[model samples]
Target: MTEPATRVIVVTVFVIGALTGCSRRDRGQREVIQNKGSDTLVNVAQAWAEKYKEVDPTVAVAVTGGGSGTGISALL
Candidate 1:
């Protein structure tokens, strides 16, 4: 094969490989699930967050414990 043909093939393969590895998921798009309340509930909230991350690696769940009032304020 000619040098130009070989170069074209190489470039094509590189482009295809790069695109195949690229994720269509928007990096900027994030799902935030906030859990707040008693410290006793913190463990359960963390567990849920971990499971969620397994399903949607991009999602971020923040768990804070300062009582229900604090949680509600944070939401606002």
Candidate 2:
């Protein structure tokens, strides 16, 4: 093929490949859910967060425990 034709084909292929491989995730909409709860419930909360993230990678779940008051404050 001619150099011009070859270059056009190469450019087209590259553009198509790049577009197809791109992921459309809205970083601005990404959120991290922070939870603070009783130490006993902390494990359960963490497990729920992990499962949630598996289904929604854009949502981050973080869990911390400092007692009942802390849990309530976290929600507020």
Candidate 3:
């Protein structure tokens, strides 16, 4: 993989890991990670979410795509 892509992935994973440690689920709530955008990434995102469930079933990652613009808008 390219250096930039690897860097981005690493950063994303780090963020996710950090989030896992501090979640609302322990207080009787669901832990959710919203992943939006990138049609090309939707497949991989879904796969990652499914596999992550095995690794950490307490957290749920909801992945969806509606073009990059849609995602950015949603974030706003």
Name the top lDDT candidate.
3
How close is every model to the real structure, measured as TM-score? Answer: 0.53, 0.57, 0.63
User: Taking the tens digit of each residue's C-alpha lDDT, what string does model 2 give over 2-60?
Assistant: 99999999999999998995876676877777887798899999999999988998889
lDDT of 3 by residue, 2-71 (tens): 9999999999999999889684445767788999988988999999999999999989999998889978
Task: Put down candidate 1 lDDT per residue, 1-76, tens digits, no spaces.
Answer: 9999999999999999989958665778886777877677888888888998999887799888888788777768
Q: Kindly indicate the candidate among 1 and 3 with the higher lDDT.
A: 3
Which sequence of candidate numbers ranks them by lDDT, best first?
3, 2, 1
Candidate 3 ranges beyond 4 A from true positions: 1-25
lDDT of each: 0.84, 0.88, 0.90
Candidate maximizing TM-score: 3
Candidate 3 lDDT score at position 29: 75
